[model samples]
Target chain A: MKTHLQNGQVIDDSVPQGDNEAVAGKVVSGSVIHIQNLRKEYASVAGVVPVLHGLNMEVMPGEFVAIMGASGSGKSTLMNILGCLDIATSGSYFLKGRDVTALDRDSLAHLRNDLIGFVFQGFNLLPRASLLDNVALPLVYSKVSREERVVRASDMLSKVGLAKYRDSRPNQISGGQQQRVAIARALVNRPKLLLADEPTGNLDSHTSHEIMNLFKELNERDGITIVLITHEVEVAAYAHRLVRLADGHIVYDGSSHIPQGDNEGTMSKNSTESSAAAHSTS
Target chain B: MISAMLNEAWNSMWANRLRTILTMLGMVIGVSAVIVMQAVGQGAQQQVRESIESMGSNLLMVLSGSSTSGGGVRFGAGGIPTLTIGDAESIGELPLIAGAAPTVNETAQVIYGARNWSTQITGTAPSYFTVRNWDIAEGAPFTDSDLRSVTRVSILGKTVVDNLFGDENPVGKTIRIKNSPYIVLGVLSAKGQSLMGRDQDDVILIPITTAQRKLASSQVVGSVRFIMVQVRSAEVMSKAEQSIVDLLRQRHRIREGANNDFTVSNLTAMANTAAETTAVMSLMLGIIASISLLVGGIGIMNIMLVSVTERTREIGIRMAIGARGRDIMLQFLLEAIIISIFGCLIGVILGIGGALAANGVTGIRVEITLSSILLAFTVAAAVGVFFGWYPARQAARLRPIDALRFQ
Candidate 1:
């Protein structure tokens, strides 16, 4: 497979899946993210249920991708494993050239502390703390001094356009503003990977667009690698690349119709469904 | 990081003002109760010591027994006159005996100039001053010559002088006791209340011979009411007492297996008994006060458990933000300690105020010692740590996913 890099999108003729996918060109991008045959299971009362069945996917540096799936698609499980909130039951998962599957809980915490920034769906913030303090929460775990943590947290809050509301608590602000504070907190540590598990899951459609626009600006300007998980197609429409999952496996991995201005592989049911969709659209 | 944790803990406390104050109220009541109760015990102990000290030096009283016997029936301890002046003189010669005085007291009407007062007239030798560790403020005590020659001379106590001779020097004055003219030789120094709550300075001192000759109506010439003995050394006080008993037994012809004819009472034994009683009283008070502290500690535990349950989502958010298990534990623990420390401060102020109030209202001494305050403070802090542990551990051990999922 060979990839041609446009200004802000990765358009590869052959999509990469796992470490063995041979990619020619700068699409490899220093092998920043590599996952091979990753699997996760949950022991429900009925029996041991496999959530992610030998899923394989890879992400290059500075790419803004969205993983879209319906309920029970295991997209959330894959996002958890990739964010180091959980470990894969089998196979290796790597980020920035380090195998995260073998790391202990403390080491994984350290990785999450310095490397990954997570934004949750509920805008999970300490309700009693000010916006600035909420943003500075993640930096408290770092070696940064108090003054620097404050300064950097303020800077991130400003970036999220909530600088004026820095002194207000989460309950005092609007839902969109609180979500912005959550985003500021996620970015305060200057992490390498920004992971959002439904960042606009609770916001109105217009406010969700505003949040998605902010994510787009952050990706374009800062070149920060981002992987967002959402079930909504309109929310996923803002990403440069789209990877769809179904029954714990990748059904489609290609550039979204927005960047490439192509309808190809947009909502492919399967490989056969992609052919059928191409014919039907023609 | 620790300061950050404290900051968060402080914020949580302020957010729930009523709960925080209620928790602290328990500690305040507990710590202050312990302190005030201990202060009362300490004050009581000081009063006991002072009361024992007012009696005299390490003294032993040998009172004549069988004085209460009537019709061949002995009633009580002081039933008969077993001590005599000759026995006192012999006991004085013993190496263990520092001093001995044969004392006989009688109530008499004293007249000086135009004023007259009824008072006690105690007859003894000059060695009575040494035995009771008394000093003459103006003139001399009646001497052995005055005792042997039966001189009609007297030394008035400060209280007797004040009563009979109002501000006038009673030394070398003439006072008639029971219509007998006796010259006042000197005025004795002032002594405070005795252990029996009588004024020690309310009597006149005169020669034993004079009293045996003129004043008291008695058939026995050499027999005295009691003998006051001072030990040469405090270490051999018991030895001195045993030797005096042996001498008295042989002198009175008290047979073996017979009851003692006299009662020997030492200040050391009296003081020890009073101290034991006070200690038992203090222990009982402390146990009762500590029950309040136990209830207070339980109150802390109950509230802390509620706080942990209420803040489960907060704990999850903190953990997701990179807080370790230790950090969560420290946050809750710090919150509890801060509450206890503030409560301790208020309790110390309240306890000291209570002690002062007790002193002011009841006119009873209430000594608030620093050691008791320190002990109460330490116990309060320990209560915080002890009662806070289980809830804090529960907070730390919570799984982040489950906590976040909880409503």
Candidate 2:
């Protein structure tokens, strides 16, 4: 029998017994990410404009969650905070059960290198580096030996089906191939969590589905936790769970199996409402 | 990790080969200029030091003072023949004076076989050789007995030997000076030049008694142009000079407050002044060349700044992949160091080549020292690090989010 807390509220309570032991300062929950009352603000010429207003979320290990939101929903900010690329204004955030808010800049960088991987929509590969070198980039920051880095990077490249093009530059490959290389680089470090921001935003429908299938396969086969951000219903449908944001607040958190027509109509209306809210605040 | 960053820097530099070379050009020119200028200036100083050494150490020249004639025409020092052989002999007996030689010189025509050349003839005792640190190359020098007997025997300078005797040994041969025949005694080992750029090995030596009797009959008895004095050591040079001046004044019976009839000049002090002047000149040359190195360092900073700005997106990508701020800084800094070191290497080669060429073309002395090469290398590296740091810091300070959003 255990007790659980969610969003500062006791959500689960088993039968109270005198023999039950208290965990005492240990987070017993097996969550990959835990955020409580996270807030972020930006100072503009007008005044302090608040972005995220006390958001709370939790992601369990091996969970495949898709975050969906319009442009002004603060979803990008949340993703940055999760990736350790940005910090929250207030409240505590934990990754892999370590307090991220207390870590310095360099420590955060090391955490990102050790525990998380990021994939961007731009397919940001070093223009002059070969695919093999690009995949080996994260291991360089980890102080891995040269021979081992080459071996692991080549192995990851082959897993992405880019073994034949290991020496090819990014410009020499197609957009789909480039995205695959980026994915290979992100996974070369074997991070516990993968954060992808619109991994298919620049791809066509067929390529988008191909990338999403690769993600799904990695999650199911390796039990790798994934937190991706997207607006398309089809992309979200590939994930096991979905989280939606509107006006800096969570609008939905449920299974990804929402009806297609209904989900599309709600997405459009939420986008419009968020845009209006953005105008009024500015 | 450092090797990986180095490899990345190499690739980026290779990708922009033209720009890299252009940026390196400034360093090349600056380093080479510094090397060449230092070589030239040091060469000049060395030449001056060598000439000063040839003039001998702890030496003094006592010149006869000016004399006013009836028409108020004043003759310069060394014109009145006030110093004499007796004065030189007395000065030689002083406690601090090592030796003194009375010398009289005049240009005269000399003939050996059919070859005749006009050359300077110096008449002095054999002790002049000891005072001047001169050595005889062949045969034997004239002795005190020869001076007493007033024998017309001469020691020939190398230049006089070359001109009058050609390849033949002039020893035990007769040479005519002003129609008076004199036997050749020996030849002098060559001393290249004096501090005044006068050829040292272009004069002939004879006994002072012989010059007074046979060459110039109009001069007063026992009188010579000047007296050459050598002190026992450098420490007592001033004391010796003061003693000599007082002794000469007492010997001449000069009245109180009256000017002496001779001037004693410390040749060593004059030589030191010349050496100091050249040292200052060398330092000035080095400083002027260092200004170019400063400009070259500025050029490196300018190019590094432009490179950082141009590669903002690439920096963002590296940061996203888990590169720390220091990692980014080191990468750019390494690139700058590589450029400067390579440039310095090429510049060293070119500078040595240029210095050799200048020496060959102009026949001027040029010295290239190991220390100078090391100095140029160290300074170039320091310049690279100093100039590269700011641009690297600017790149490091960039936020990953902002850099990623940059176009």
Candidate 3:
């Protein structure tokens, strides 16, 4: 698909769905937002320095993208803006293809709650609450009925393969299991965007891979859009595409070299491997 | 959301268990102090009331000789001389007067078979028993005939009986009193101890006529020393006292400006005084006890502040997870209240137990008034809210990004 930028310059890309339809020179194809000329500045004793400098971004519906960066690369600031935890100092940001840069605090909070599911690096599970209760927390905040919340929370837990451990405290579970619980908690309200900030940063290599695999599974199986921030290349490999940021702007956006064995590919690969095993036995 | 906030608070409190407990300690002491002090105070008051009741509530004590200038009889040092047997006779004539008894008292050391008891000896009218609410546990009082004939006979108090007769009944036996043999007439009933720590039943009672004729031998009984009178009912006591005071004042010819020599004390007034005094004491005690509750509240405040600091990271996490400032604030605040209420519950149990134990040891009555318990619980809950607010606010105001970023 070819779309013209604001400068009437032609840009070519494959449109995934109707979410990428053009609107005032900005792509809007079921994509809720198009970030253009986004900028963030921090004032210290030294003076104002920008953290996000004219950053261009697009979030399409049902697309899992990872933003990877080295330390102090302003990925966190970008994630904050995306999650509405903080507002960008100056930006042309459209949410659901509608401008949300002018929204008030209450509106922003409502938007964050309605659309965003944040999974932190530390899991951020309330240590004293049972897994089901933790998962049911967002529904509680939204004033969902007790019975409905319980049913939904249980379903979410079962989806994460933690149905049996629903009554256990977060501390009683393994680190990977806790992250899975956090994922369940985040997804309970069925938020439109899963915003995970270095979700596997605190885990070991094997657990980190397991978490990444689970994220990939959730993105593929449930079709939930995920925007993950990470420093690790291995962690970013599970996503369909990786966007690398340096300083305050995107330096790279492409598929990583590593092939993530998704469900359909795994099934086909498994069939081939099993045939090879059968032939060898014969 | 409220419940989630509560859960957040509970978790934080549980995480810092020691600090939380220390915080609750101030409240515990404050609650216990208020409760226990009031209890002890009530108990002591009850004890005094009971003692006064046992002393006969409507009885009036009348002493002779006024301290006025123009009295014919000089009552030895600063004494009242208005009261006399003739005045007792007039008081007895009143319909409201139930009984009247004239008395002459002397402290004596009596010896019997190698045992000695130092006690008061009283020469009294036959109506003394009725007037003083005294019953003869064994034997009888001297009759009117015994009094008219000047017969030497005596009845002993319990202490005197125990000292002189042991377990044996000494009625109809002859006992020596002041080198004169007087027949044992009766033993007075047990009246416990007096307010001044004197044994109430330690005295000996004899016929007033016989005491005057046989021992002191003067028609003028020194200064009309003592009289114990009882009214027909407690309601008529004030009227009876006023009437007697009026009669004595007229007979003594005291001027209006002069301080009356004789002091007439009704047991009812004495009882009221005692009760009032005890109530004041209990109030002081209650105030002191409340100090512990204050201390416990401070403890809770201290722990809550520490908790606010300790859970800064967790608070940040919740704020990031779509929690508002109010949510975080309420969570910690709820935790603070819960701890105080817990301490209050425990302290109430301890206070009641302590008060009951004190009552047991002191033989005093303790009434755990509902108001006291309710007041304690309210104060404790208030302490929680008051002390917890600052910390909760601090937690709520914490920026989510900042908190999560806290190492």
Candidate 4:
């Protein structure tokens, strides 16, 4: 039996009754998010075509998962729903034991503020403002006092190695430097879940690897949940687990054995979905 | 929030310093015109009042004709022929009238030494100084004895003294009036020019008996030019005028309700007319100046709209960062108002300079009233508020996602 939480996500309240219980049940916890039978579709002149089809996923309290898919494989669609940027058409989504699928846009925004931090591919910085101002923007919306917001934003920028550029405009910096500032801005509000969609898309491969390393350090040290979306298999390899989607369905979900510290190699030749499944069982 | 808004406004203004300065030019010129025009108008009114006061209130000038050569009826010609030495004597009997004098004037040439000067000669009784509000600055005026004896004695005005005597004293000296010798009794005080630009102190005054006996042609005491009446106080002048007009009209056998050949204008009426004309002119100038203020406001609006377009991406980023629409609106609106208010402040300084320039160019006393300055500033602020609102609203209503994608 599934019970609906106030956030509109369904909680699977049934306790396991041995091996048979692991078959179809998706367990949702008191401090985590769970998704089951999640579907999203777009109604175009070509009729209703599904973007996400009967997908199932779970996020633990401190799990760092990366999603890998091609451009049209529905990875971003799933990330948007997970980050509360959009709502799923038919799904049971649970966040911290509360159902969140039925909440309105305002409530969803509230939840995103309280629970999610998003880093976009474009590093959406206000071009004319200082880096400190960009980092303090979210806190400004949350009604933080001016003095406190400045102090916090400065500290966050310094931690992200952007302290020297705190007063500089976005146009005065390189792409990697801008992305570092974006990362500092994302962390300023200290949200529980960091949803980064192609967070290093505009950076060089070396900068991308450095950014992934920073993400890994943040996840391990702060125990914050991290969900990264990327088409590059090498970028995804930095995560502890991988969810591969194809034709709007998760073709594989398992522990990924990436080259332990190979920052320069693409992990695409590591194995196929079938081989990964065989390796997981062995 | 207010600090952020101000920063936004101030920075935006400096973003295009040349455009902002150019826009302020319209307001500066407009405000200056209004202030200068008002000051000059006020100065003109004051000059008229001073001229009237200098002419004195006691003198009543009467002409025989009802109209000037220009075809407009002269104001005080109604009781002219009937107002003679007899009416003057009668008016002297009134309680409010302290004295009355009959006058006769003629234009003639007076030869002294080898120089010939064309002068206006006035004949009047010995009491002319008292009734006409004139004073002697040198020697003495013609006395009662001179009037009784029909003495050929005269008092010279400043212009006559300057021409006939130069630096020498003219008192007790002999001068020719129409080929007849007359003793110069005194030199009158210098009264400046009148509103018509004519010299008020140009003519010479002689005893009425001398003017009648020496300069008269072939007729009886034809007509006294005017009866100059003097009263105890300015407060009683109106009463004195009414009494004289009533006595003269009755003596001339004029009916009631007819347009009297003569008119009476008091100092108060003349002053009031001058003031009214000045007020009307200032009001018209103020309206014209207000048009420039409107144009300044339009300039602000146009610039603000352009600013909104240029900052769309910034606005989107702010919205994405959790700023509400109202917050964005306030930021832009505040900027526009700040720019306009700054313009107004500078315009006020320019307005003061304009008023001073007008005063220097034309010797007019322009008084800038506090209310006028305040009104101008209030209109400026209102222009800022009114025109700045639309562009601010446009910035605030932009969708976050669309704004960020504007590229």
Specify the highest-lDDT model's number: 2
Q: Give per-residue CA lDDT, model 3, range B253-328, as digits (tens).
A: 8779775667677866777787798889888888777766777777777777877787788776666656677767
Candidate 1 displacement at residue B385 in angstroms:
2.5
* lDDT digits (tens) for residues A44-97 of candidate 2: 999998877766677888889998877888889999989988889997788988
Model 4: per-residue Cα lDDT over B1-407, one tens digit each: 56655765666667778987876666666566666665666566666766667666645443443442233444445334545666667877888877878778788888777777888888888678876567899988887778678899988989888787788888888999888898888998887767566887988898877777787553246457666666767777677778867877787677876545544445445545665876687678778878878888888789889888988987766665556677788888897777777778888788888888767887567877777677777888788889999999998878655676677
| Candidate 4 structure quality by residue, lDDT tens digits, A1-282 | 222211212222232223223523545464466776788998899999888887766677777887877768788888877866567889677776667898764466566656777788899887767889888877866778889989999999988898988889989998888888888887888887888989988889999988999899999998878888987777877887767776676665655444333442545555654334323432
Question: What's the lDDT for candidate 1?
Answer: 0.80
Best model number under TM-score: 2
Lowest summed-lDDT stretch of 10 residues in model 4 chain A?
Answer: A2-11
Give the per-residue Cα lDDT of candidate 3 at A196.
94
In candidate 2 chain A, where is summed lDDT lowest over 10 consecutive residues?
Answer: A4-13
Least lDDT summed over 10 consecutive residues: which range in candidate 1 chain A?
A: A4-13
Runs in model 1 deviating more than 4 A are A1-33, A44-47, A258-282, B66-72, B105-222
Candidate 3 on A1-282: residue-level lDDT in tens?
Answer: 223212212122222223233343644657855787778899898999888777766777777788866666788998888877777899677767656789765466567667788898889887778999889877876778888989999999998899999899999999889999999988888888899999998899999988888888888988989999976666766777666666675655545432334443242244232223222332
Q: What DockQ would candidate 3 receive versus the native complex?
A: 0.29
Report per-candidate DockQ.
0.45, 0.65, 0.29, 0.24
User: Of the candidates numbered 3 and 4, which has the greater DockQ value?
Assistant: 3
Candidate 2 docks at the CAPRI level of: medium
TM-score versus the correct structure, for each prediction: 0.84, 0.92, 0.73, 0.70
Better of 1 and 4 by TM-score: 1
lDDT against true structure, model 4: 0.73
DockQ of 2: 0.65
What's the ranking of the predictions by TM-score, best on top? 2, 1, 3, 4
